[model samples]
Target: MGWRRSGHFASLTEDEEKKERPKVASDWTLAKWIMKYLFKDFRSLAIITLVLVGLGSVLALASPKIMQVIIDDVFNTEFIKSIDERFNLLLIMTLILLSVAIITAVISIFRTVLLYKIGYNTVKKIRTDTFTHLQKLSLKFFDTQESGRLISKVTNDCDKINELMSGGIITSLIDFLTLIGISIMLLVMNWQLALWCFLFSIPPTLLISYFFKRRARKAYRKTRKTIANVTANLSESISGVKVSKSFTREKRNIQEFRTVNQENREANMKAVAVFATTFPLFNFIASAVVGFVYFYGGWTLIFGSTAILKAVTIGEAIAFTQYVSNFFRPILNLTMFYNTFQSTMAATERVYDLNHSTSDVVEKTDAYILPEIKGHVKFEDIVFGYKENELVLSKFNLEVSPGEAIAIVGPTGSGKTTIVNLLGRFYEILEGNILIDDHNIQDVTLNSLHSQMGIVLQDPYLFSGTIAENIVYNQKDVPFDDIQVAADSVNAHEFIERMSKGYDTEVGERGSKLSLGQRQLISFARALLPNPKILILDEATSSVDPYTELLIKKALDKLLSGRTSFIIAHRLSTVRNADRIIVIKDGAIIEEGTNEDLLAKKGEYYRLYQLQFKDQENGSNGH
Candidate 1:
């Protein structure tokens, strides 16, 4: 079993395989989409945050200028004649600066809280929209997708977008405005100092930014891809752990994990290398600019009365140095913000594509609801294939009267399951039509069609919940008595009652707590609970033991009473009583009739019965 299962869990692709769908051309579109969610959904919070940012910037700019006043005006003996008046002026300026600092701190606190609310609210909407859109997509979209990658999209990628919404873009915008405000203040006080500082500092800042932008973008994108890959590998490994242990493949599994983990480490190291170099370089440039300001300002102040150098006050000199520091602060902040922006852009690209990806199967805008049906079905010259240029079923046709029971038998890959799938309209037929009760399936709403049908696959899936919950899934407001009745009908009530908690016993993930037969019984109970007009059991009894299957066989008549049914099974004994036995080969029906009639004909159906059913009869007679 382990060797057989190995191929299913083979190494997965690191990226989602590309398809023919259109790609997003630019990161700007994703940015705008995120902003739209932030502002449109929670406009009040967004507006309030912006206003606080603007007010905080104003106070930030004012506090530094007030320092200049305190130095030049409050303490100047020439400006104020009396000592008491100068002291009084000093007290007032001190109080005003204190008030500005206090107000700025208060605003900062409120702005931080608002940003959190905005970030969470925006992300909630994005996650919800992504999930809702995914639900609308056809099964074909999911058939080729890796489950781990999809989980990564919903969890990790959305988290990156949340980071951007909370603190990345909004604060960076405020920082830019603060940078501009500092520049203007410096120029107003002294243009020569401001011009000289810009010449030395601005060029290097721009040069560094230009040099790292592309590298950081590529590095961060690789990191995002690698992380998704790691997540996918982890998910697959956990799912296949049983098989791996069975085959003693622990060492091999560990080695495979190490390979993926190492790739992730390398990608992160590349991004971190860029991050490590950027801020220090910016900090060095800032320190040099600040030093130059102090040096030049000191020379001007010391060389007063000289024709070549302008006189500068001590107060102006101190303020000029502070302003230069403020100017570089935003630049450094921008450098840091850009790194985060690059990662967010990578995440946004995957999320945006997922959100916008169109479903290959779509219902018409004007498609009407399918009224309660009588279960008459028709497949008129159907043609389809799971992949391009391949045909699983071609020029195939079948008509089932209301309440007829059909048993489809064929060799593997002979399109037995595809015939039933077409009846349910799970896949679109390439060149034909499926009609239920004279209503074209494509013309009817999917919900109305699916609501009246019940399907039980070969592998029964039960969610993690109490047995009662699993049995009553998707059918709201069902009475406990009704649940017991459905379970009893399928012979599940006896075992369920034997458990400590009876119907309330937890089934664990995918019903792992129960035996395979028990899970199949629960699935049968679930399917029957709906009392659907059409019932499909595709190898539904394959997992049940002979004893449990015998119990199910006894109740088959009651389960199929007054409902049209299609049964696809490998065991010849299961379909001996169907209203019509259709023997298919190479996607075409080669024999069709009652069991006795087909046996008399000695055709494909007779041959299958002789090969499969004769052995079962002989073993039973011998016993």
Candidate 2:
């Protein structure tokens, strides 16, 4: 069988579908999106960190002074005979350095806790917002996109943001702040050496900073893209494994997956190349500065009184040099972070675009409810097209009265489902208005309108839970007695009782534990549970066995009584008893009448009924 990729996605309005994506507010920068959106109460976390980090900085700066005092005071030539003085100074320096480490760790702990809050909360909001927007999006949008890609956006891509928020951003900033404090201390002790560092390291530091960020970003982008492809391939193969096995297409699928997997590997290797390069470059710069200091400072000491420049104190000089090396190291880390930042931004853009996508059908601000809708639906001179100068539906008109049963019969591409979709307010008409009880449907709140309707699709999906839970999906607060009554009405209660665990049994994934027919009956029961005024059955019985169809037919009669219904079906016999059967072809109404009326006319509907049901009848009788 050939598969076509056509979906409602392609039929989106040219203007609405392609509107420029909405953007995050200009004031909503990276920090604000993290702090404000994720953790509104960041003040406490921020203040605690500030206090501990401030203490850490002060203690660290005080340590070398203690070192200088011990060397010049307690260990001086005059005090050398006093062992007590030496011991006291040694104890003081130990406590000072130890205090710095303790304060630093305390601050680190608080920061880590805060970072997790930022990550966890942001992900929660992001997922919620993603789902909220997802629900708002018209069915057409999802039709064209790959489900796996959507899943990745929510799962893997969001995870990258979480990782960055948890540690990447916070640690990078903290390290940067620490580097600043150390540099200032070194400058206070020796401006000449500090000046050397600032001047000599400028060129190479900037070069590596720019190079590593850009190259690493390129690698990560490729990696993310490759991973998405791999995800899509996996979802496709796994979801359709039965078809693949039956058709013997395993080798082809494997070959395709391998190609994507290799691309992901190569992309990561390229990223590693840049990642590995940063360390060597960092070492070379630090080492070169060490040589510069030794050679330059030694010449000054030999030729002049370099103590005026503090160029000969062993501990102080060592500290100054250590500060210089330590200061420049963070730039390498910052560069790598920049790469992760870029990948994160790209993922954010995709998500933001989805959230911002304009709805194809926007409700009017002054719109009112279609009051007391008698279920009289009319498509008056309707015209629609996704693209300019091309129309899928043109000049279409149909009318149905209150509580009327209409069966729409058509071939594969006859636009049978489209009519149902429009009636349910899933899409907007391009030219004409769709009046429900003489009120335009576009004027009504979607939720208010949809609540009155129940739709059961060909493939009914049940969440992983008890059968009772699935039946009460729409109204959880409903009493158990009501649920049993609905199930009993649809003849589903008998089967539920037959199960080993009754309604409490887990349906497993997608209701896999039950036979397809049983699942359909359960879906029917669920839809009818709320007693919706409107019902739509689009191939609802197509996957069920004939015996189950018979049971469903009986249940449907009881459930559909006195309700407006549109049955989109290929099984003509199911709708043979409908009050009015309409035949549609190429987006136009070809014929319409009562069942006896259409069959008597001997037109499209008659021919279709003959072609499909004739074989079933012949097989039954062995004719």
Candidate 3:
């Protein structure tokens, strides 16, 4: 059987796509939202962090005061004293400074630890919540989103939030507080000199910061977008490597990847350039402040005549210079902090958008569990579409008796697979009802409904695990004997036992280590092990060789004996044994009956059967 490739629903224009993208809040708004949520549960940890920071800031501010005391009281004193007395005083001051430094270091260590705990734990919860939300979303969400973009949000975006919480938030707070404390101390010591420092330093610092903040935010935003593009490209390239090789498009793929990489590189360079220019400007302003202080204060001390300032001793001048350095230090650090804060805010906005997305398929509040369904299914006047004003299935109706087998055949885009999708509740119907055992599927819990249904798609997916684990997946505590029995029923046991590790053999990612036929058989065994009341085989044997196809047909006969099974097949021979054959066209059922009955009608199903099976029939006749 071959699949007819139908073009996807038309791609939306850029503007329309943007409109459909998740809405992101303003940076400040998102930051505040995250802060409130984080602190709601980590209030005590936050309080402890603040206390440690406050103590550390106080200790840091005391350094200049101690320096001033040493210079003014000991070095500049005129009182006569023994050398030993002088040494003892100096030693005592040095020991006090050492003690303060040690205590502050200890506090800083504890503060960092606490901040990390709060940051990591909060991010862990956020990541968990985001993943859980994604799980509840309908399959339609995945169809519209890129896997790489979604993966980036879960991993890269959360990491950025962690950076903000663990370091950016706490360090910025401490630096701001230290800036304020230093300003107050500087003014108390020498108001005139402090005035000189502020006049020269604050204006330039503010100007430089204002200029960089806007540029940095724009640059980092571009960087984030470029990185996401690169990630998306890489993911698609890896997943479609086989197709690329078959089409000899390796060079083209490389060129495409290189283009994305170049975009990312250019964006990073722009951000780096902004930082480069901003840092030097900050240093120049700081140096200019120091120069003004020395020139003005020295004139006052030496000449002892100035209208704007009082005369100062050498110790006071030295202390003032240290305070000047301390002031600009935080300013420079704050600039870097602002950059990190912007990046985090951007990431937060993305994460928040994903977590808040609404799922189209939602379980009703009063939905009840499906109690041991007996495989009777009904579709009444169904109307559905993947996009607005473009229905894939319209006014569709069907009824299946318990333990009956039905086969569905249609041209691609005739809404064949859509039936199974609707039955499985992967997408919600626009207008109509689907019932299992007379209970509306929408009114039943998804878990309870899904637990009783088994589906095997055209391309079987096997996660990274052992063969045995993949066979008994989700059916907990299934013994080896039961696994072997299921495999044997599907002709998978013979090959599995022939392998060195038997059932314990590892299947690499997506079962890359196994052939397509082997993977299908394993999937068949997996679905059968659960003994579901309803089984769906959508083109399940289409890709296998003739020998494997025969094996699958034999297995299907046994597996479908007592189940309400839906088989969607392109191969006419495969559906010949079905109790009923359904032919759909243009989202509507045109003909349906037993295989022989449909053939005798010489209608849509008859034409399709002839087109697919006529060549084989002719070959058989020649033989």
Candidate 4:
């Protein structure tokens, strides 16, 4: 078997598939897309945040200048000979520092709040839009995708984008600005000292940053991919836990999970290793630059001549060293931003891919809404398959009249379910058209086509909620009396009412609290609640006990009344009561007629009937 990768549908074996990672859009492209969302609706909030950050950075630049003023002018014996005057100047500078600190603190609070708002709001929009787009996708898209990986895209990926918006982009921008501001201030204070510092600091800093940038990015991308794999593994395991236990495969499952978790840990450690080496190198460079600034500045102050290395003041050297530290601080922050940027790029690519995916079964642009159907349906020369160049239904044709009950029977893999799946427009037929009441299904809006039809699957799925809620799902303002009537019609009311809370009883996750037979009964009632014109029961009673099947059979007439129904069953007994039995083989109808007529023909239908009936009779005789 082969699988499709990402949003594109192409069949490739595990070994034939490329081992290299799929290429994504450049970081700049993805960053621009994220920025569009960040500012699209939250423009005002983003603008305010930027202004506050810029203002804070400017204030921070002023603090170092104030320290220089106090050291050089207020306390200098040569500049301030009078004690009273120096004291006044000192007090004034202290007050100015206090004022700047207070204003910066206030700005920090506002900036933090606004950044959070922008981050969460942007993620909320992306998450909401992604889910909405997912609903528009055809079943084919979901058929090829892992539910866990899709979930990771919506949740964990969006969260990564949030980390970038909340603190990464704007903070990095401000840090870069602060670095520039410190560089300029240092040069203005004493050019000679600033020139030497830049020579030793800037080149080494850029070199180290360049080295780590590539390594960290690749490492973080791997981390994101591995975590998504972990989530997918965990989700699949949880969903199949029952099957695992039944097969006594708990140990195997645990070992599999451990392998995935270890992969995640290794990927994270690789990223950590890159980060761990980066900071120390930057610190070493910063310390070396500061040390040289102190040495060179002291040399000029103590021994140097008049013209070339102009002598500097104690206050100036102190400010220059402080500015060197300030310069490296922003470099460190920018490094952190690059780390976040890499992860965001990885996540954004996935989320964008999912949101932009093309569905295989899209309605035409001018498609019309299908009016209430009378259940007349026709499949004209249908040809289809789940994968390329593989036809499950080839040149198949069928017509169903209003109020007719159809039982389509065939051996496994004979395309029985594909017929009904095509009828429901879950997958598009490659070669022909399916019409409902003479309106081509492809020409009708999917919502309109699906609205009048109800389907019950082999494994009936009930969402976690009260029984009443699941019974009346998506049917607003349904009365209790109507629910009770629907359940009663399916013989589900007796069991429901027997429970302590009756209709209000919780079904638990996927209706795990209920027995298989009970779940099928509930599914029957749910399908009939809307009084759909067309109903499909696909292996619906296969898992039920004899007594439960009898209950369903007793209600079958009422449920099948006045509706076009397609019953796809391996159990020949279920089809015996259908209006007509269709015996299919290899995507073609071998025989189809009333049960007795088909049985009289002694054809494929008869063979299937004898096999099932004899097995049942022998089982009873053995008991």
Candidate 5:
């Protein structure tokens, strides 16, 4: 039986074989996205940036100009006093330096605040838009994506962009302005010296930067991959702790976890090592530039000073060196910025992929919204599969009238739950259609179609909230009296009232504190409280004890009286009173009729009942 079950599990459905969506390209470029994404706010950001850059350039240029004055005229009052009555040199220097500092500080503050506002506000809007887009994605998209991966996109990927916004934009802007300022200052002092420095510097900066980026980008990719793997593994391990303990596989599990942990550490360290290597090299180049500048400028001022007319002074040379050194920092950052650009683009593609999926299953624009319904259902040549090569249900047919109960009994893999999934539109039917009240289901709005129906699943789900809250989830404005009435009708009120807080008692996550019987009752109350026109109880009473089953049967009679219901049950008694019994085998209805009619025919249903009774008899000592 176990081997057979394993074989059955290997089979995939036609729907599953639908082409998997392509992953976002790893080498995606951020340039196009940056242009498009920021274009809407470009005018404002550009105006602010230009204003800031102009201010920064003025400050950079002024630094050396002020120093030249301080060294020559402003500080050299003794030299100038012989010619004329001197103004207070110290007081003049103080005012000039103080004014420059004030302007620079103001510009820096304005740039910082505006950059932060643009970046953070853009990311916030992007996150909100992405999340809202997800809500519109058909279930098929989520079915293929791992929950952890989806969560990573929403959180980790968004977080990366947030960091980039906070510092990356401002750094780039300042670096660009500094580069411009440095170029203008160096040229004015000595064009020959500036040209030499610029030419000699490009090769090492470009070559080392290229290699460093290649290595760092590769390492970063590995780090991202490892993080995703670790998250997926951790989620699975924690979620299946029961299976781990039951099999006593804790040692093996922990060992496996250690392997993933070690790999993650290695990946992260590799990325860090690459970043560390490049930063030092970049610093070395800047130092070498300083050394060259000092060597030539010092010599030029002393001996070579005579070659040029009124050769550059000590303060002018000092200012040129400051420009040379300060300029390289932004150059280094802009050169390495490509690495972050690539990463951000890749994340964007992924987020967009999830947001813009065109669902294979979609209602037409002309689709109507289903209103209050009588629940007449028809499956006209309905067909489906989990994968392309494997068909689960083929050319199936069934008709159920309003307010009538029907049971679908089938062997495992005979498309029992698949049928239910199709009806719920969780998966699209490959061929044909399902109709309710002569209106095709595919031609109705999903929200309206689903609203008219209620489902109590085999493993019923109750979120972490009070029982009353869960029951009245969709109908929040419903009075507590109505909630109690619904609970009492389902016989859930008795056990619920036993709790200290009654309906207000917390269910814990997924109602873990409740007994199977108790959960089933609560599920019933939750389903019926909506007063849906159609109800599906898939293995509804299978979790209950005999006494609980009897109580549920009474409640079931009341609930099923006016609504069309589908009951998929294993117990023979549960289906005995169904208006019609559908005995299914190998994805086809092998036999189906009323209970007495099927018994008279001595067919599949009868044989199944006989087997259950025999098993019962054998269990009781010596029947």
Candidate 6:
């Protein structure tokens, strides 16, 4: 049988397809955009950091020049006649060098601290904002995106961006400045030597960088994808470990995880290989330029014509060789920056893409706040589907009066739960409107609309916190008395009090420590504590034991009184006392009446009752 799936938890959906497709080449637009928006707030800190880096670079450039001065002039016989004067001059030069080193170190340390602060703050804001946006997004968004991939975006992607900001940007700037400063100094010292070095060095530098950039970008992109896949697979496997063990699929899961991990390792190896080869190639080129300078400079000093020999001093040649090394170092840094820039741009593109995605359901600017609902609800010609051209509910219409209790019963995928989902605005209908107390749900702010409603799912979720905290979640200043009263009303207080810590007991992750029935009872109490005008119990007791079902049923009587309640149940016996029972098929009401009236009619509801509850009743009688 073909069935339409309704929730994201069923499988990875369309968004995963979009993520897997090759990202369009960003051309650094995303990098620039990140700087423009995310880092704009840290402009002052960035400016200060840049200034400090610039100062440090200038000081570093002066070191080679000082070495030239000491070699050419400080020790020259003609320059320093007295031994005492020479000693004083040497001491002064040494002090100057030491002072430069000390000051540069101080500046470097301060700048690093500032950059770190800026990077962390920027990521914190981005992560917080991304999470906030994710929360505001429609259920359709979460339905399509993988949770692990989203976690990677908030965590791993943000870290890459931080690396770019904290290290890549400022270091690249300083390297470029230092390269230019050293290049100019070399040319000024001896133009002929400088010209030859540039001729030999620049072409090879450009060629090597050009080749590596393309490969590195591809490698990093692949790494990101594979790692994300591994993370998503791991998260799914861990969450479903119980199911895997129950089905004895442990070996299969392990093999699948191994495949994903191997892919990630391969991708990372490719990226590392590119970096490993590129750095040494750059160093070889730089060293080759230095070797050429020493050979030519030494040959000129020993055997060239007098003019040539005089033109290049020992000190000048030594300084020029140092300048050549300095120049190539920045070129190498810039090459590395190319790799960093590409990876960072890819991460930034993903983050911005998520930020720009508009939610399917959005609140209007002029949407009204629903004032204290009386729980009168109406569904007008609702047509809906979870996927394209596949209608789950077709032109469905229903009206519920204030204080009425409704039981919606149908086969799987018959759209029984879809009714309440639409009522909650979890998914927008393709056509028509849902209204509460005559206020169109779409015209009312979602916050105000949801505030007055409580939902208890078949599989209820409980966070890791004390029982009291979970019961009073999001309710401001809820008194202990109210919490106790709510738990007592739902028949949860007795079991809770029997626990070692009572309400203070920790529930553990997803309330795993508690039995399913206990969790459901707490969920019911949580829903009831809010004192909502409307309550929805979607198969709340379907998975519980018979004794637990009795407890739930006793609680439901008080909970449903004076409140508009919709109960979607698979077990037909549970809905027998509902004020009205609606039998739905293919998203439309097939029968609607009081339980006895529908049973007397012997229509769809009667058939369902007979097939589900009557058989069970006969078995009990036989026993």
List the lowest-lDDT window of 10 residues for candidate 6: 1-10
TM-score for all models, in order of appearance: 0.90, 0.85, 0.89, 0.90, 0.85, 0.89
Error of 4 at 603 (Å): 1.6
Global Cα lDDT for candidate 5: 0.76
lDDT of 6 at 261: 96
Q: Over 4 Å off in model 6, which ranges?
A: 1-29, 37-39, 78-92, 214-237, 240-278, 302-310, 617-623
lDDT of 1 by residue, 1-623 (tens): 12212432211211221231234736567767887997789988899999999989878898768888888887665674577777777899899999998999999999999988898888889999999999888877888787767888898889888889887989888898899889899888877777888989989987787556656766776887798688778877899999989999989988988998999999999999987887788888888998887788678767653543455576777787787878877887776686686567667788998899888778889999999999998989988898988998888989999899999988989999888877777777898888899999999988888888988888989999999999989889999999999999888899999999999999999999998889999999999997889999998887678877887888889888888999888887888999998988888888899889999999888887788766776774111
Q: Considering summed lDDT, which 10 consecutive residues are worst modelled in model 5?
A: 9-18
Q: lDDT by residue for model 3 over 1-623, one digit each (tens)?
A: 01002212112122332453444775556767677757787888888888999999999987777777778667865847666777777788888889899999999899989989989988998999999999999999999998868998999999999999988988988999999998998888888788878887877787787678667767877897898789889988898999989999999999999999999999999999998998888888877877887888778867885667777666777777777878877887787786686567667888999998889999999999999988999999999999999999889999999999999998888998999999999999999999999999999999998889989999999988999999998898998899999999989899999989999999999999999899988999999998899999999988876777788898888889889999998888899999999998988999999999999999998888777666676764111
Off by over 4 Å in 5: 1-61, 76-96, 225-233, 246-259, 303-311, 543-550, 620-623
| Candidate 2 wrong stretches, greater than 4 Å | 1-69, 72-94, 218-236, 247-274, 291-297, 305-312, 363-374, 386-389, 613-623
**All models: lDDT?**
0.83, 0.75, 0.85, 0.85, 0.76, 0.83
Instruction: State how far residue 14 of model 4 sits from its true place (Å).
Output: 25
Q: Which ten residues in a row have the lowest lDDT in candidate 3?
A: 1-10
Q: Residues 1-623, candidate 2, lDDT per residue (tens digit)?
A: 01012322223322331343243532135445556654464566555655655555455556565566566665566655578767877788778778767876776677677668767777778878888888887776776677767887887777877877775766676567767787788678777777777788867887777666556656766887798788879988999999999999999999999999999999989878877887898888988887776765686667754534446454555566666677666777766675566556556656655666667877688866555556777888888765557776898898888788899888887788888888787877788878777777888888767877788889988988999999998685988888889889878899999999998989998898999888988898888887887889998987788877888888777877878899988878888888899999989999999889988999998898777777786774111
What are the per-residue Cα lDDT tens digits for candidate 5 across 464-577?
Answer: 898998888777589889899889988888989999999999999988888778877888898889888888988777767777788888888888888888888877778889
Give me the runs in candidate 4 sitting further than 4 Å from their true place.
1-21, 80-88, 210-280, 305-308, 620-623
Report the C-alpha lDDT of model 4 over 1-623, residue by residue, as the tens digit: 11123312122222222333254555466667788887788888888889999999899888878888889888678883588878888999999999999999999999899988999999999999999999988889999998868987999988988888887888888898898888889888777777877887877787787678667767876887798788778877888989989999999888988998999999999989998998889888888888887787778868973554767777777777777887887988886676576456667788888888989889899999999989998899999999998888888988999999999998889998899999889988899889889999999999888889989888989999999999998898999999999999999999999999999999999998999989989998899999999999998887787788899989999999899999988888777989989988989998999999999999998887788778887884111
TM-score of candidate 5 to 2 decimals: 0.85
Task: Specify the poorest-scoring 10-residue window by lDDT in model 2.
Answer: 1-10
Candidate 5 clashes between residue pairs 3 or more apart in a chain or in different chains: 13-385, 13-386, 13-387, 14-385, 14-386, 14-387, 15-385, 15-386, 16-386, 17-387
Best candidate according to lDDT? 3
Candidate 1 structure, TM-score to reference? 0.90
User: Model 6: clashing residue pairs?
Assistant: none
